[model samples]
Target: MRISPAYLKSGILVSTAGVFGSAFLWLLSFKAMAFWMGPEGVGLFSQLRQMAQAATVGATFGGTNSVVQGLAERKDEATRRQFRATAARLVCLSGFAVVLVIAAAAPLLTQFFLASSAPALVATVRWIALAVLLNVGGTYALAVLNGYRSYPYLALAQIAGPAALVMLLGGAGWWHLPPDPQLLSGAFVLCFGVTCLVGAFGVSRLPKLERALRLGALPKAQSRAFVRFAFSNLVAALSTTVALLLVRSWVIEAKGLAFAGLFDAGWTLTFNYTTLFLTACSAIYLPRLTAAVRPEDRRACMLKTAYLVLGAGILVCHAMVLLKEPLIHLLYSSQFQASGEVLMVLVIAVIFRGVSWVYGTLILATRNSRILVVSDVALNLMLLASTRYALDSFGSLQALSWAFVLPNFLYLVFVVEYACLQNRLMCRRDIWPFLLAGTSPLFYLALSGPQWANSGLVTGLSMVVGLGAAGAALLAYKKVVS
Candidate 1:
């Protein structure tokens, strides 16, 4: 089977648009939360979200990637059905277990995380647990859709969840809902449930999925493979989650809740928007990488993906650094204006993250779970350690962005070396794009510094030249990939 560039382009556009919609909707919801709840309120909500994410990752039993890889590689319907059956049973059982654990520990969780064990807070935590349950199922459905390369349906399900949240948030105004943590957590549960239902409906509409759902028992061998993958994936996912949580908690403890809120505003912008580039290519790239048997073919897929991601990421990150002040005002509030500095440095980290995503996808696609697990854990650990050091040395939350930059840059080096040594994926031609893309953000940083930031003529000229450079690179990359 041939990989058409047009097909790749269409899939990327649709998937990116869907993710953009979700990001935009969340931005709207966040703007309301910022207005009503203020910076400290946003901080508390961010903590709750981190907790939900951790629970959701655990609930899935690390089966998300396994399901995607399994279905993508399996050719026979019967085999795919068996594997899907195994994944379903594993995720369902694990999701239930996670809910139980969270419910049982809610009071303790509230005391620890929120620094109080109030009954109302426990209830709020329990609501988040429910969201985790729903989100787990939703994530599983998404993995299946991704495995089958169902881009359009996958896009729809992605948008529906966030759209539901926006609608619920809007309804809250009409319903006179309290802007407490409970209401926010409940909205999370409702939106996740909606996403799950939409995704399941899409799964049902698949030609083979209905029969697959009905016919197979959970095979022991497949279950073990899924479990193994789950463990590895869980470690990586939990590491990243817990690392961020710890960092946020540390910031809250050190600088206070209001400061953490500002940091989170910048983090939200950096993480959400940068992920749009990854989401754009992931749906199509993973399945294609899994299906390609020859090393040459895999290498080609990796190069094309890296170029597309880097090309787009460089441009977007550049614009973000340039317009971060206004963008922050637009997405958040004037109160969050201080986060502009954070956003400026964070975009460099975002660029590094984009580079890592490209290579990381290849690592995951090849099912080199140990490498993935180790690199992820190490990177997160570096992030935590470096963050503490940076905070102490610089004594500013804006300096937090530096913690991620070096670790991600190191991770980029680690993965590129692995790709070359273990799989021979990189060539001489691939070197320049990575170098150019990686350094592009630095140029933006330089231009945005105190020395040149005030010069409108310089900034305007830089924007023109930067965008032109991006377009030329895209054209050149198109020629190479084609």
Candidate 2:
């Protein structure tokens, strides 16, 4: 059941490159786009992007992720090839239909969001529809590459798409081209198209592409299996998407777009950092977890993976929290300084998310999509209720920030409990490490006092003490885990 060192290393490299490359481009794009378009413009763009992603979740029917999981589980070449062909045909047709619906609905959707705002808002929403359409095709290709475990090609496409878009936009800006929503949307379409083409080339490298491309290559049985696997997952993906949109809309309506903008910025930064690490581990471990023969062995591997990922996540979150003030000051303007507290809350939620992925991926690898679907529904419900209550009571962005933390923590608890009960996770070792790591933040916060004594040196000294405490706690954690 042990993973090959070479494969593990390769997976790490590919995942790291892909995650970091995408993150870099996105961070740069946001900075550049915000500089040109202003905070509200970036906020509008963010809202549009989230809407498109939500639409894509509906349009793709959630088959992409399910396809990868199913294909990873398959051993027979014929079955895999048949599944691929069926998936390809279904995804393409569904994507096209979804695009048509989105286009048709764009006017009404834009009108609703604009709500007596500028005409430019309506135009931006229309362009976002086009971006969403192109994204659907690109996402399918990326899913295919993931299914085949073509990590290098997937990584390459991930890098190329964002890098190209950023370069193009930066060039345009440098040449004094006015930054308009249309230009931004066009950049997205172009990048996505290029990525899709590159992903097609990658898929062609698989052994059975020619056979898969042939009409009627997939038999009825495989098609049935694919549908069975993909349908439930689609529902789960769609529900999650709805939950996100609901939260965003609620924030905008109740609080305001400016507050939502701050939340978005903080959430984006926190999620990218934590997800990059967790995703790297999942990419490497999921296939091995799937290929495991014995329940006990699989349980052991899952526990080890969880420990490693959670440990890493704790370290990263601790560092960020400790340096939150200084980091916020350095990266953002005074308008966004309040985001530091939001960032702290988000970091905690993200740590739980990182840990939950290990258990979630194990469920996925085992074709237990039912568990994922159920968990997602329950968690989303909790998130919606909590978010609503928080906003109603606190009426601050921090309320939204705090709302994210508890649901994720509860979800992680549920996932771990289920895994243990199902005999797919063993070893109580994770509990002690989690408790110790979780308390490190309290120690850091305790030493910060009420104020910095109104001196730059004192502020610097306070930060040093907080970070040092966190470092000591982390080292202690490593020792205990080892």
Candidate 3:
């Protein structure tokens, strides 16, 4: 079940294009929305969107990951088809339940979730319910694609849906359509629904879908196993959602809407950038790891990915730090300059996050979900407590910014220990390469002054130095590994 280099390369390209392109388009749309509707409007939009995303995680109920794992374990086409069908059925039912909850909570969400100043923001919360339903549909289709290893089509759908929404929203904004949160959210719902419809069509082409959809097709025993697997993931997903909501709600309550907007924008930038690389890496690596025959091969692959992603994270962090002032000024209005420092702190979190993610994916592939669930719960609780204290003690937004780093660092340490205990992986040796490669970027950032300088010149130099150092380290690592 090893993936060919050609398939891996194509997957990398498609996944990167999908992640980065969608991120770019969505950021542009948000920028446009900010310009037309103001920071508070964007803040309201962001809050509701986050809530919808968090809710959608519950609706998905871990069915997405279960599908991939189930497909990998199944040898017979009939079994695989049955797994898909059962999973899809559960997804639909769970999504309906979520929709009902959203509808029931809409009034409270409108009044309390939104900032009091923006009374008109209630409509956007309602629209998010529709968007959540569409999102669940899209996730189910994506799960099917992942099960089939249809990476290219999955990536295209990911890019297309968001791209369409951004374009539509930007065009409407340009035409001076009355810019409101509800209007913007409605546009999102429309785009998501269309995307889901398109994806459903693509998924229908797989013969397994028809096979799986037959009534009473799978054995009762297998059906129960599928439910068990999905249920574990559902619990993990729900816990993760609660963790995110706790952090986000704290930011809104403690700081203010304006600070939340800044934090959201900065966090989005850092997360999206890291996701661009990680998504591609995960897409190619996860299935391979799951199907890996030898412990040596699995450890080797995981170590390589960890080093590469860690280096990339460092390079991105340094670049963001170096160009923070100018990039913030250019991409967003002056108000967002406050996001510069926040982005810098977030960049640090991203570095640790990259390491944690690589090992975390390995754990999942190994079917060690219990350990992961425990680790994640602990990390999230620590994050919540620390962030609350930081927010209370420090008057600035750095409280939330700083809170993320410690838990991620702790997770990285735990992951290294777990891998060593489980696989006899040489964490001490493997980690040094990543640490050495990561330092060059930090050094570059430290040496680079924080003064507002010529935006173009500084940014160009930062790009050159950061990329050059990262590229050299990667080449050196390849030579050593080879």
Judging by TM-score against the true structure, name the best candidate.
Answer: 1
**lDDT, candidate 3, 80-199, per-residue tens:** 776776777878888989888887777676655553435456556767889989988987887677667777777777777877777777787688887567787787787678768867
Runs with alpha carbons beyond 4 Å of true place in candidate 3:
1-4, 115-119, 208-217, 436-473, 476-482
Rank by TM-score, highest first.
1, 3, 2
Task: Tell me how many clashing residue pairs each candidate has.
Answer: 0, 0, 0
TM-score of each: 0.91, 0.87, 0.89
Candidate 2 overall lDDT versus native: 0.68
In terms of lDDT, which candidate is stronger, 2 or 3?
A: 3
lDDT of 2 by residue, 1-482 (tens): 23367976787788778867877777776655555555555565567767777777776766356766767777766677767667778877877787777667766776455332455656666677677777777778777777667789888877777777878766775676775766777777777777777877887787653534554546777678667667777877788777777787777776666776677777767875565455445555766787776877777677667656665666566667666767654544456666766776687678778777787776777667688789888888999999999988997766678788789889888877877777734544555356345634533443355354224565455445445544544554454421
Number of residue pairs clashing in candidate 3, backbone atoms closer than 3 angstroms, sequence gap of 3 or more or interchain: 0
Per-residue lDDT tens digits for candidate 1, residues 265-331, read 9888887556654665667777888787788887777777766666676677667766877888887
> Local error of candidate 3 at 433, Å?
4.9
List the pairs of residues colliding in candidate 1: none
Compare the candidates by lDDT and give the number of the best one. 1
Candidate 3, poorest ten consecutive residues by summed lDDT = 445-454
lDDT of all predictions, in order shown? 0.77, 0.68, 0.71
